[model samples]
Target: MTNFLERLKSPGDLKCLSLGELKQLAAEIRERIVETVSRNGGHLASSLGVVELTIALHRVLETPRDQIVWDVGHQAYAHKLLTGRLDRFDTLRRLNGISGFPRRSESPYDSFGAGHASTSISAALGMAAARDTMGGSEKVVAVIGDGSLTGGLAFEGLNQAGALKKDLIVVLNDNEMSISPNVGALASFLSRKMTSERFVRFRTGTKLLLGRIPRFGPGLLGIVQRAEGSLKGFLTPGKLFEAFGFEYVGPLDGHSLEDLIETLENVKRLKGPVLLHVLTKKGKGYPFAEESPALFHGVGPFDRATGMVKPSRERADTYTTVFGNTLVEMAEKDERIVAITAAMTDGTGLTEFARRFPGRFYDVGIAEQHAVTFAAGLSCRGLRPVVAIYSTFLQRAYDNILSDVCLQNLPIAFALDRGGLVGEDGPTHHGAFDLSFLRPMPNLAFMVPRNEEELRRAMVTAISHDGPFMFRYPRARSEGLPLNGTPEPVPIGRGETLRGGVDGVIFAVGSMIREALAAAERLEMEGIRLGVVDPRFVKPLDRELLVGAARRAALVVTVEENVLQGGFGSAVMELLEEEGLMARMLRIGLPDRYIEHGSRSELHAACGLDADGIARRIRKVVGADTPVACTPRARFTRG
Candidate 1:
């Protein structure tokens, strides 16, 4: 047989292929995805699961004209292959490479960009509405996973689509799993396999037979339809979608090319909000992925044959691991402590906690907004709730964090993981704005931990405080220092001087402290003396220490991993200005623009946040161009 994948130039080529050829192409696509992801480290199981469904959709629909918005675009790797990206497939998620998720700027086939979940339906509906306004006949479809359906935003889109009564298609990809096994009533509802093919055939046959009857055929059909509504409400999971004014289709086999293509070809002609329920297995073709779908959902590069992840060069425990262990230890001593995650039990390092204290753990689905308020409610009942969420995902619940938690001064501890430039996943997943946004909020204490030990102490402080407290940590490994003693609550709004210098001072936050220290050491060798200060709390800043440091040093610099605007650097600048300090100052951080996807080291260097970059900037600012004889090292101080 010929190589269908290599010969296929675009989605239009799929229309010319036979069903057998399409199946072969799917096999080839899976091979390509597995090979690439095995090397590149991407969303494996989700992409592999959607191979057949992607082919079927591209085959039937006139893509580039007919829009298909994919929810949480990780599952659209097959879609990327089917589009004109096969040549560049190897570069997925790499710096200056094709994105892991659908990017509108990258291709015309990608109607809308997606990295986050539950936005597809609304975007597709908006496209459909625009098409209607312009009187265009283009078909709009949204392929959403059962997991994404659990988000409240998906339902909001559904509610609006039902009322507008536009011609739209919604492909419900029921794989029965999200990143973690899905939770909530919607997951349970979609899991009911009551609407089988046999039931569908029987219902169709009965309707046809009744229509064939004499003059009373119409009356008999009406009675059967009314009865069927009640019956479907009891038997099928699609009654909820139907009640939302959609014409519900079968729960068809998503992997069956013939069934998918035929059903899609027929459904394309239907009008007014049609939902096609297609059942699929997560990690369908890959054996290893199928066995542990969640593990492979968003994985690093691994051995494709043995299904083992490749070992990293860094041997230290990740900040996430430390957080999980510390939380579990803390929970052991306190019964009022409870943990909550918005469907990221494994990612947020809460799996062991959930197992150890099942009753106190809550996986609130992909509902961050609800998770915040729900934690607030839990706190109201005298329970200590720790809402663990990725910094980027927590942005979705900013309003809730402000109103429900901060404004009310609730004692809820928010552990924001992935608090800096998360490599590979890119701009959509980067946690660069947490400090900028949370800094100005009232009645909230925000802290950035420099290492695993500091993170443990920050956790203790957050829990001990009687108000809304949030702390952020990076996605990288912790500094290999031993986690020696029991964590204790540190004084709030305090900073410690790490190294003392006479010429200049550098105030660094969180992960940037390492780079700052390195930069200071390098400057010392070049006859320049610099001091480093770790401002633990960004919110209740140590004004006295900061003002005193500024008064002593000729030049003061602020560095952080977040964007420069409204970030840690800005906060320092504000403090210095208010104290009437006239020291020459420079701020180093992420650029004002959205950062592109790249390795953390590369991104840090690019944004001048690395040791060398920081040194160069400081030298340039202080007008120190020539290197002289080495000077004595600055005095090292802990506090």
Candidate 2:
């Protein structure tokens, strides 16, 4: 409704605005976020929800110098808009515009870069300790949500912060949510706020309270002091945090700017660590978000006028939807099958599974370590535990996956959703490295499906197997190939030829099957018949199929949507070496660096992994076998 966004160049500019104008500014920011996000697409509800809080932090604290580290950093969109990036906001999350999350390189205000969750406290503590070491005096505050508080890393940070006794501030942004509703012990404790109170026991103990009584004698004070030890316990419920050795404040009104600003300034002075528990409504300015905040948490492009998001119809079914439907169907037949997620039920497509088997489904907050170990514990009790989690978040539980599940060699199914590049959310959200990490783990089986039908089959195969297994799929929606049939298990550790020829060979995995097929067709048109193989399992490579494919062609190329170093292609290279199928080889995948933010299609095309890139690589690798046009680089490489 207004161009107030132009007037705001930085958080520093807001100092002169009255509280009412500040509140209005919060609305304008939310409006701009909704308007832009509805076209560009981004984390909608979380940004809307944090409007006033972001404003209050800037309004109260000295940033960059003071250091405000946002947990997860997805909610930092408002912070970005306020901190001199509003003019460049159109480039938000686009390649080399401005990142969706805080990047130290992007601006002076972004004190730290973050995309992962539950890491703010430790980061802030580090900065504080650095400040102490440099003898520079500046406030370092960590803004963490209640959802993040559930993660073990956050607690690890909290525990260490308590022991370090640094002058650090941890703002517990408790809307009681972390993608899904917040779960775990800390959230439950924060919600039952201020029902208990404690008397300021004097510097000593109960003796002081009784000693202060005008008529009490010293002899009687001794007896009362002994009783008071147990008496104080009855009144004060949780010094759970105070036990960790820090002053605890709030469970205050987070929306009231005056209260927030005043309370923050007051705690800003208190010595040692302090937790200000500020409660605010998520989706504060938007009515639709207020009504169903979870759905709006990370929204797609939508109509701002009616609050209706346009649906994606490029493909028949999303990979997540297929996975969720398969799990639901399996859970229906098998009573022992259980599900686990790290605070992502709907996002992982386990909503139906959770709804159908509420008793069996465990949404373990943001604690990925706990979820893995918890599933392992369930497996010990003869339950078939399927952990439905995103690929990126799973990186957090590497230790848990190794020590808890893989070490035991239990029959746990790791349903890794969003297993490839997740567009726009950027590098932190990309599912590019699960292959490299999981492949080397002992007793772990890794695989991916070519399409939805194969995914259904893979699910059945995973459930039927007796040891730990993992299956990953892309974030892109399925190619719309119908299920066409019921659940059927494909043989474990086996892959088959999708198409075959004698020219150069292309071995692909997961969603790359489509790319492989497209590349093959392009080659065929150019009189270079290419062989295509889908090695459904990246681990335990289809030895016979791979060797046969290698022998038939003069050159071999392995394709995957993962990092090139020690990934699926590397596995194929090892196979070729062992078999002595010394055909010239080429590798195509992500490089040994962080891929920047952009639309998946744009990144794919630029990296030369799309249909055309794959076809060209195939042509270059098979230069001697078939005469083909080549670029100067390709010609030199071939020569």
Candidate 3:
């Protein structure tokens, strides 16, 4: 048979296929996904689980005209293939290639951009409202996973949509997993809804018996419908949804192609807000993914046959492992020490923390805002809470971090992981903005570690501190540095001078310190003497070091992995302006624009943050004889 997937140019092509052809297409999509993701390594289990669901949606709805907003976009592999992007599928998650998540800019078929969780229903509701206003009769659907429901935003979106009573379809894809296993009240409720044997038996039996009546069958069905609320309250778990003003449908099998198509077709004809509960397996097609969905959720390149990740190059320890291990050790000694995460137990390396100190570990389930405030509440009772979350996800809790934690001067420490350009996941996952956003806030101490040892030291400093303290580290591994047996607290707002120079001074922070040092070595080849300083704290702005460096060197350069605006560079620039320094300044960091998905090396080179780029730029700014260039690169000039 000719490959149906090859002919599938668009959703319009999908509509022309038979049910059997559609199943074959689904199989082909799964194979292509397994092949591509085996090499590229992305959200494998989630995408494989949603093959049938994706096909059913595209077949039922006229996409582009009709919008489908996918939550998190973790399961968008099949959607990407169906929406005229199959040829470019090989480039998924590569530098300047197709994104792993849905990007509105990339395609009109992608109704909304999603990288973060629990935003799809809101986006879809907004689209539905816009359609009503414009007198457009387009259908809008939001496919959300059960994991997203743990976050309060999904309910907020549900509440608003329910009250508005708009024609919106919210498909609840309940796969019983979310990176880690699903937890909390909502997960239990959904589980009850999915596994209620009594409800299933009663509902099926009632429908069958009613249809058997010759003359009074239609009237009997109407009578049963009228009494459904009272009758279903005892048997079904949909009463909760009924309270929210959404017409609840299903507990349907997400893998059943025929059932999904028929159900979706019928649901499209119905009125107000509808919540269709779908049951699916996370890694539906593949056995290895089915066995350990969490491991394969977002993986590196792996063996397709054996399902083992390709052996990584020998390197130093990752920042996540160091942070997790150190925290466990600290928590063992201090009874007040507690750990919290937002459904990233494994990703954040908190699996051991959860194992060793289960009583102290809290997995808040994709809720960053709740995690912060919860940590603050813990702090109020004299418990020291360490909230470890990815840098990008932490942005969701900015207001909470400021108002609840910072304003009250709580002693909750934030261990921000993936604190720089997290390659492949792209702009949404990058922790570039944490320093920029947190810098202006009062009563908060920010620290970035240069290596594993420094990470341990910073962790110690944060724990010993009395108020809100944050320590950020990159996604990359440590520089194979050794850790001292015991962690020592470094003085707050202090910086270490790695090298001294008379020509120019380079003030680097965190991950940039290594690159800055390399850049200095390259500059020396051209007889350009450049100094390197690791200003450990971004918030406190190492005043004495900045003033002294400015006084000693004719040219001053600030380097960081964060963006220029309101970041480490901005803090230095403010200090230089305040101290009345006559030294020339250049800030090297991420540009004003949002960076695209790529490797860290690719992004670093593109942003001129790599060693070679830094060396070239430093030499350009500070010539052998002259102090400052007559005309500086417009982008690097902070002022």
Candidate 4:
């Protein structure tokens, strides 16, 4: 009912408001988010948690000049409001409104466009180093949540930040949460130290005073540091970060504006790569958010007052749910089955599996690289490791996935969630390149399930089968069939012909499988014999099935939600060339252009990966033979 947020224009206006006014502003912001996101679903919990912190940052730091890089920029809703984007705030994550994360094109204040985690510290340090190199006076700050700290990149940045010892401000927003509750021993230690304000003050003051004084400072500080390390080990946790050469400071209350401001100011003035740990509660102000922060992490449309999420009417089962439920069933049957998620137990559909089998479940917080190696280690021993992760995020650990898992031929099931156009989350979130990247890897078997039944079957086959195996699924729901299928073991490196035809065979991956099937049915109606093949594994090439299909069909069309270059289509083209089958080849996928924010259907239609688009491609290939009523617009726009 109130438009108080509209009244306040800039950070300067926000600065003039008193503490009480700021609290009211927080409420207003939440109200606006609920109103907007309920109508247009976006990240709820993360944005909600950062409200006060966002206000404090704007109030303390000069914007557009002082670069602040937010790690995994989903929680930048408040940051957006304070910037010049409040006017267009109504159209968040729409066709052409505003983005969910920070974008360079969106506004000047957004220092970097980030949807991935564990990048803030590294990126911010880069900006800081550049500023120093150019002899600039702008401040460089990185706001990273605790969950993101699980990422090795953050540690690599921390190590560099410490070694470089440049004036870099790395603020750890310790909400004891980031997507999921902070896990691992390091998270627990940081969280404990965060609440221990008295201890932090004592250690920092001693270090600053002792580390200074020029001549004897190094020797004296060294002795004192060693002494403190031993003394603190008894009183506090081990100092893994201090050894990294960072001036680690408090686990201050992030929610308390006064404390946050005071601590930030204290660290701001300090020089030579300082680390300030600010403790805050995720979904602090709102009760529902406070109670179930994970649910609110990146939420959809919901009933604001009651904090009730709107149930989807589509009734289709998402690929994630299919994977998750299938995993639980497999784990129940076999004791060797274990699951791993990179801080996405809830997102990856492993929550039920986690609940059912606590010991087997491993939620490696925001650390894709670690999750891969960890799974590899599990595989080395006799245990089956299933690393379930989003496609885009999984790319962060490409080297690890290739070298550790694939090269070694570890029997790990990579359940790729949101494998295609993820919709609204934009280019950063889309798992578009999985098929292309994974297809080339050695000892790897990749599959894309058309429906819930295949998704379950793939997981079941992966669990029992040896060597590295992966299967991708979409962000949308399942086939509403409750994963009904005979538990048929997946024939590795084999393609199944969904519909038989002599005209052409459409080889589609994951989400495209459904569309390819639909296209087959459409052609069938017109008395055109079109064949559909769901190539279960990409790496192996399904030689027997594919060769037989190609021999019979006049054309081979490969459909995937990835780039044409080095993508599934590229693989198919390579295979055809190798086999000496110069049949007409058609590729369908996301364009070369970086996809913008839009709904799933909108993005699919635009990219021409939908059923209609798939059919058009099929028609183009087979249409050449017969007079099919169609006009050919370039279905794919090259990047």
Best by TM-score: 1
Better of 1 and 3 by TM-score: 1
lDDT of candidate 3 over 532-613, digit per residue (tens):
9988999787899878877778788999999899899888877776665555788999999999998888999999999998
Could you tell me which 10 consecutive residues in candidate 1 have the lowest summed lDDT? 177-186
Better of 2 and 3 by lDDT: 3
Instruction: After the best TM-score superposition of candidate 4, give how far the Cα of residue 254 lies from its true spot, in angstroms.
Output: 1.6
- What are the RMSD figures for all models against the true structure? 6.1, 6.0, 6.1, 6.1
Please give the ranking of all candidate structures by lDDT, highest first, separated by commas.
1, 3, 2, 4
Ranking 1 against 2 by lDDT, winner: 1
TM-score against native, each model:
0.92, 0.89, 0.91, 0.87
Best by lDDT: 1
Please provide, for model 2 over 443-478, each residue's C-alpha lDDT reduced to its tens digit, 9 standing for 90 to 100.
988888889888888888888888898999878778
Q: Scored by CA lDDT, what does every candidate get? A: 0.89, 0.81, 0.87, 0.80
Give per-residue CA lDDT, model 1, range 267-315, as digits (tens).
7876799888877888888999999999999999999999999999999
**Candidate 2, 336: how far from true, in Å?**
1.5
> Which ten contiguous residues of candidate 3 have the minimum total lDDT?
177-186
Off by over 4 Å in 2: 1-4, 177-238, 624-639
